[model samples]
Target: MQNDAFMHVRKMFPDLSSHRHRDMKVSVATEIKWVVFYRATITTRDGNYQHTIGQRKTLSFKDAKIINLQYCMGVCTRQLPCQNSGYTDPRECSECRCPEGYGGTFCENMAESTIPDCGGELNATSTYQTLQMEGDFQAPSGSSCAWRITVSLEGGYRSFYRTLLGRSM
Candidate 1:
């Protein structure tokens, strides 16, 4: 990961010495599934002069996918509301950076799923509730369902539990 970090930085500053990473500070900002977000700060020296540079980038080693590598390196100045566990996407200021199961321009809707009639919003209450789903599990490669569960009770806590039972055909 450190090597990939230097390679990414070198893309912007080709003249930067590879050895300069000794003065670099790389930290994990967030991790979601297979994606890992990183924030790197480096201190550079030119004779008696010194300078510092920082960038926020993401890397997915399993598939070699890097998010926000070409954009959103700096702070976003746009004011946009992102809903349902979503934040402003640096790559596209007008869109929200949604979590794994959410999507939309502002993350106000459930993500599209391959399975028909499988995604929507649900409301939970104090009583026990159940959500059951049955689909063809043999070829479930790209099938998915996203549901947003919300509770309106104030000053109360909620707990959720899920169980999956599958058998080979």
Candidate 2:
């Protein structure tokens, strides 16, 4: 309800700045006011899309609740890394703006790994209790060979695989 509330809102939405006047009252509600103000500013553009949360004048207490105060208040001034290579406009919220290619609450998966070359081999070695390796495929014998790459952990009990297509002669 103090300056901290407004600070929390600003922390959540870095792209938005309070457009309120200098003499405006500050309280817990003030954060909602600024959210409404900036939510209008950014979304009302000629071609900008309105956010679902911005469609209403007043949100239910649950909707307006500051769900993650710890995270928001703790890193108000920090530019946190996006989970999955999401784009973060410096002027916008500290949260990552995930691209279409990435899909997750935090945009964790952004790019697909490039398949290894036909003749390339990926080998991983470890001196620990078990061994681990990840890379491209090894050299091929002929034009008509299919390669299946498997990745195993230290004990070799957990394994995942991908099938690589064969090259045409």
Best by TM-score: 1
- Identify the candidate with maximal lDDT: 1
lDDT of 2 by residue, 9-102 (tens): 2322111122212322223234333443354445434332332234357642222323333234444466556543343433455555543233
CA RMSD, predictions in order? 17.6, 24.7
Which residue pairs clash in candidate 1?
none
Q: For model 1, what is the C-alpha lDDT against the true structure?
A: 0.39
After superposition of all CA atoms, the RMSD between model 1 and the true structure is: 17.6
**Global lDDT scores for all candidate models:** 0.39, 0.31
Q: Kindly list the per-residue Cα lDDT of model 1 for residues 1-169, writing each as its tens digit.
A: 1111211212121111222222222111111111212333444554112112332363332112123423443557874686654666665777777554456888665566654654465555445555444432232434454444444435652211111112123
Segments of candidate 2 deviating more than 4 angstroms: 1-76, 109-169
